[model samples]
Target: MRDEIKGIRPPSNPAAIKDALDDIARIRGRPLVYPFIGSGRGRGALVELADGSVKWDWITSIGTHFFGHGDPEMTRAVLTVASADVPIQGHLQPNGEYVEFLRAVSSIAPGRCKHVWPSMSGTMANENALKIIRQRHAPAFRVLAFENAFAGRSALMSEISGSAANKKGQPDMGQAHPVPFYDPADASSVDRTVAAMDDAFKKHPGEFCAMHVELVQGEGGFRDAPREFFQAVFERCRRERVAVWVDEIQTFGRIGEYFMLTRLGLEEWADVVTIGKMLCGSAVLFSSEYNPDPGLVSGTFAGYTAGLALGAHVIRRLRADGLIGLQGKIRALERAVSERLQVWKSDRLIRDYTAVGAMAAFTPIEPDLDSIRSMVRKIFDAGVCVYYTGHGPYRIRVLLPGGCMSTDELKEGFDIMERCL
Candidate 1:
């Protein structure tokens, strides 16, 4: 299996594939972020590009494809749904697969999470969560989000997101207050952040409906918000009556245990949790107290039937296999990677590294976005596909495929990364 997957090659006419991709990008009036093009062909951790080039996909569809691409079980679940001939829409007409998916999700959710509302993507899930917060806490339209945090790119979500660039031309969708996230390396970060949250409440007294946070920030450069920090913030939110909404969109299935919040022991305080990406679907899990009335959060398409089915399967496996949690395989994999990163700490080029759960980033000593981009391109040229994130001090982040890779496979990937560097 390894030989077959590793031997996969790029398309004979790589340039033609890139040209076609460029043409399509131009037609769409958008530039390609990465020159790479997908061929819709992938097996395990490898993806075949339109150019016929097969590269080890470290991004894993940006943290989707938890079990890697084209898993037999996922494919079978999808095929069964496809063969059913029933309509894919689940809001008006509930699908058995979607029902199972919700059950699985609700079971793993720390709090009651008695109410589950499915959406098509992470952004929609977050948007719907915000709607729920508004419905439950009427007259409170403002939101509290952390700086460098990412919610999504939808109209409302763009404003909620930390990046101003995502909402550059977009009109304001909601009242958002961005506070600094906790940086353990910074001695006074927690105190300052807590103070900021307090100030936001005072400035907009009774105006905030929800406090949205990514326990382990993903697109915001894979940073972690310490337990003490979260505890402190949650205390303030509780006092202010602001609903705590944990956005596990990127860190859900990939993180330690079932969810990052749960891993951090903060689920008890979270009123609503939005999850998506590798779960095969997205949904908002809220306490019964926050559950909205009918029509408050309903969508035409709850989720893809196949994806819903596969999502249920994925959740079941994660629960049964014990790949998460404190002593879980995922945690072990994270430790392994952390240890490997230490070997490069002494190297002058590598400034530092940060990881939480399956997400990690290697920071350079002297940061340069263009240099990191060049490194990524060179890494791709070296036959290992990876990506970079964050601005100014960009990092070569690793979203590991733990479900598919063993210790040896992971070490091999690390070795490849080192060679590329």
Candidate 2:
């Protein structure tokens, strides 16, 4: 079986992969993250790179492959769709996958979320969310979002995101107002955040249509907002009639709870929710009250047929495996990572760590961008793959697919990380 799987992977031509990367860089007119290509041979927690080298995939394609690479069930689901010759693009004709996939997503959504708008990417899902909010609250131009929030790469969402860097060289929508996110131990954090939102609301009274939050910021350093903090913020948005748009692009399935709104107890207040990454298909789940007018939300491609099938399979499998249920794999991985952090705390090289379920991030004591990047590269070279987050004070963020990885496997990856450090 191992040999058969190996044969199924990409041609083990390291030189060919390297040459392709060079060609891509030359064509795109910029340097790229060279020397890495997925071989599609990985099973569970490990991946075989195009260079014929195997490494523990701690990043899991930036939380997209939540079940890890070459998962048998995922493969089977995709193969089933492929065998049927389902159209790659399904916009012209409605398919059963669309209905079944939406049903699967709706099953997990809050009761009020009666409508689902399918899109090709997280950005488009968010874009649709904004469109729905705009249609529901016409002429209400302003939006509310947390500090360092990341929405998507699209022009409109780039404006909605809190990062100024993302909006560079793009025309500003100039509609999103930034507010402070929750800090767990900070007693005054909630008040400070509320004050920010209140100030923003007062500045643009009746102009704010919606507020988007990650609940747990993913790219912004995996920081989490406490339940009380989220509840207080949601209350303010509700009072101001601002639709709550939660961006679960990176936080969806990997957060252990399947949905961060539910994990953070903000599901009831979630007027619009955007989900992507591990689910394969990205979508916006909105309440009936926020449904948009016709011609407002449409896409050329909702998602690929295989992704749609695999998404439904993933949702069902995760539920059956209890990976998203209480004290499940998410919590188990969190505990494992937390235990490791506890031991690393005594190490002078370790600065701080944050372990939130399946996502974990840590910073070095003497941190710099170059050092962080070098450390990540070293970790990858040392047979484990992780990623970096944040700027100025960067962190090593590891998004492990705990549902498919064992605690011992996690320890082994951490061991490689330690050796790399």
Candidate 3:
């Protein structure tokens, strides 16, 4: 695409690749996806084009590769670990890398939370959180999840998220009501809507096992929870005797001290914290020190060599290299993007703006098919990547990892985005 790109394969025909994938999609079901991203590339964080052009990645697997794709440091660990011949599904034999990952993660993720379980994905991690919550408060069938919360696609998680559409038609869709992410942006909204959650609990009696929350609701359009509000919720959950679960899958490590929960001082408050995306850089890490028993739950690829090795490398790098406290970098980026977008707000292309740590977002006033198409197409053509969330035409999200991008690179990407708006 750019005369010649550095450090990647010669590239394959994305159209041909698309055609093959299209056939698979026919059976895969045509779910409407947001624009900006075409199909992702094989290794590098580039979106492969039909003409073989590539665009920079913004989503980063919804904030998955914290360090970056194709990081040589991670590769070294992967290559060395694959030489082993143990059956990872054995469940009982979690190797040195797995043990090392857990130990480091426990030490790094708010010392108050000293336990973690390896699972397959963000959804699995969420499921584990749900399981842990119920077990901790057995008779409590309910769990408090915010309105636009985006957990994952498991049967339980889908229900908890209140996105029944995602479930499509799953038989046992567990129930969790939507609490307003708060309406500072919505003018006609009456009152400072914080009771949306309390309203839910009133409808359904003491069945709640916990209040599963995200310090930053990334999928719900990058909403930030007031720190005091989180503290209040923790105090209430204590009174209700419900477990507190924080979905750190999307927010942890984007910035702040390792896990997002710690940013809210939720380390001591959270009874269980679920982490995925960049947790071990690949595998899902769930904590259940107060709740895990041998066969209560497990995943086929839990702490496999590949994921553990990659995760270990990522964890080790953060500790050894001081990559965890990059909050200043995030603040600067948020200021740059928000200031630029504000000028365009009157143009009505933007509906809202918000930021938490390095996780950033802005939204369309009225998100529709054509509106989404125009914004994403322009961003893609200009060579940046982003994604969508919520049942609403939520926002354009950008993930700034420690090394995958430079301040200038992210700035340049946003400069192109400004022109697109």
Q: Looking at candidate 1, what is the lDDT of residue 36? A: 74
lDDT of 3 at 400: 58
67-113 per-residue lDDT for model 2 (tens digits): 88777888888777786556555556758787778888888886477
Please provide, for model 1 over 267-295, each residue's C-alpha lDDT reduced to its tens digit, 9 standing for 90 to 100. 78999999888887889999999988888
Could you tell me which 10 consecutive residues in candidate 1 have the lowest summed lDDT? 1-10
* lDDT for predicted candidate 3 compared with the true structure: 0.65
Clashing pairs in 1: 10-52, 10-53, 11-51, 11-52, 11-53, 257-325
Shift of residue 29 alpha carbon in model 1, Å:
2.6
Error of 1 at 411 (Å): 2.1
Would you list the C-alpha lDDT of every candidate in the order shown?
0.81, 0.81, 0.65
| Position 278, candidate 3: lDDT | 73
Model 2 spans with C-alpha error above 4 angstroms:
1-14, 89-92
**TM-scores of all candidate predictions against the true structure:** 0.94, 0.94, 0.85
